[model samples]
Target: MTIAEVSEKFGISQDTLRYYERIGLIPRVNRNKSGIRDYTEEDCKWVEFIICMRNAGLPIEVLIEYVELFQQGDATIEARKELLIEQRKLLIARMEDMQKTLERLNYKIAVYEQVVVEKEKELKRSEN
Candidate 1:
């Protein structure tokens, strides 16, 4: 696959793909004689992993550390696990915060509805 194909498949922009490569977020994609990117299935899979981690709100620095540890092979398995565990905890906390915000929004919506009803009652009284 080429860069265009990867970008389309991942729903990411080509510039983002180039940026990822430049930032060492993903491994450098191979290029053909023409110096155009020639992405392989393995390379695409790595990009998919990066996208998933990013969607999960994983920080880029942490991801870079993960990638570094990953390149070290089996010796870094424990370290990688620790990184994932820490990230998971952070995600959980964020989720909790979002839940509280949702609850507050719901409460405020209910208050608005109550005010609307009160205004409607006032209008009905004025009509009488």
Candidate 2:
């Protein structure tokens, strides 16, 4: 498929696809006789994998490193696995931080609710 078709299929813009290609995030795409990009199923599969990793909050640098390792043949398989493990650890830490933040916000909201309730009671007493 063409760049436009791939972009539409993935819900991403053409520029993004080009940027991904430029940044070594995705493997190089084949070009037609007209020098237009012609994406194959394998290319699209790689793009989808990259997109999924990105959506999971995987850093671009890590993704780049992974891509490098990937292109380096099967010898770097262990290293790539280690990188993924590190990313999982970071992701877990991030989730923990978010949970702490959520807890704080919940506590603050409870305080506000109590304040509102007390103020309402006070207003009722004043009106009596």
Candidate 3:
């Protein structure tokens, strides 16, 4: 598929796709005879993987390193696994922190809700 098609299909900007290639975050996409990018199935797979990793909050440098390792053939299998494991650990820690923040916010909202209900009750009693 052309870059435009890939961009639309993946919900990513064309410029970002080009930037990914320039930054080595992804392998170079092959171009057609007219010198336009024509992403193959493998290229699309890389795009999907990169997007998923990025959405998971993986650092760009780490992703670039991972892509480089992937290009280095089978010798980097263990290294790649280790990298993914470390990233997963960090992501879990971040998720835990976010969960705590969410709980705190929920607690604050509940307190406000209770206060509002009590104020409404007081107003009703005064009217009565």
Candidate 4:
């Protein structure tokens, strides 16, 4: 697919796609004779993987390391697994923290709701 097509299809900006290529986050995309990017199926897979990892809060450096390991051939399989395991742990921890924050926000919102209800009751009582 063309770069524009990939950008639209994936909901990723063209600039971000270029940045991913420049930073080696995803393997270099093949260019057509005109030097425009032509994303192959494999290239699109890498883009999807990187985008998912990024959404999961994986660090750019970690992803870059993973890609480097991937490029090093079969010898780095165990190393890549270990890296992914470590990153998964970190993501779990972050999710736990986010859950706690969500609970706190819910609690605060409930408190505000109760206060409003109490105020409404007070107004009703005073008018009676």
Scored by lDDT, the top model is 3
Which segments of model 1 are wrong by more than 4 Å?
none
Residue-by-residue lDDT tens digits, candidate 1, 10-89: 99999999998888889889999999999999999999999999998899889888888998899999999999999999
Candidate 2, which segments miss by more than 4 Å at Cα? 120-128
How does model 3 fare in lDDT? 0.97
Work out how many backbone clashes candidate 3 has: 0
TM-score of 1: 0.91
Please rank every candidate by TM-score, starting with the best. 4, 3, 1, 2
> What is the C-alpha lDDT profile of model 4 across 14-73, one tens digit per residue?
999999999989999989999999999999999999999999999999999999999999
Candidate 4 Cα misplacement greater than 4 A, ranges = none
Displacement of the residue 41 alpha carbon in candidate 3, Å: 1.4
- Among all windows of 10 consecutive residues in model 4, the one with the lowest summed lDDT is 23-32
User: Model 1 misses residue 110 by how many Å?
Assistant: 1.2
Clashing pairs for model 3 are: none
lDDT measured at residue 68 in model 1 versus the true structure, 0 to 100: 85
Candidate 4 has a TM-score of 0.97
lDDT score for residue 66 of model 2: 92
Error of 4 at 22 (Å): 0.5
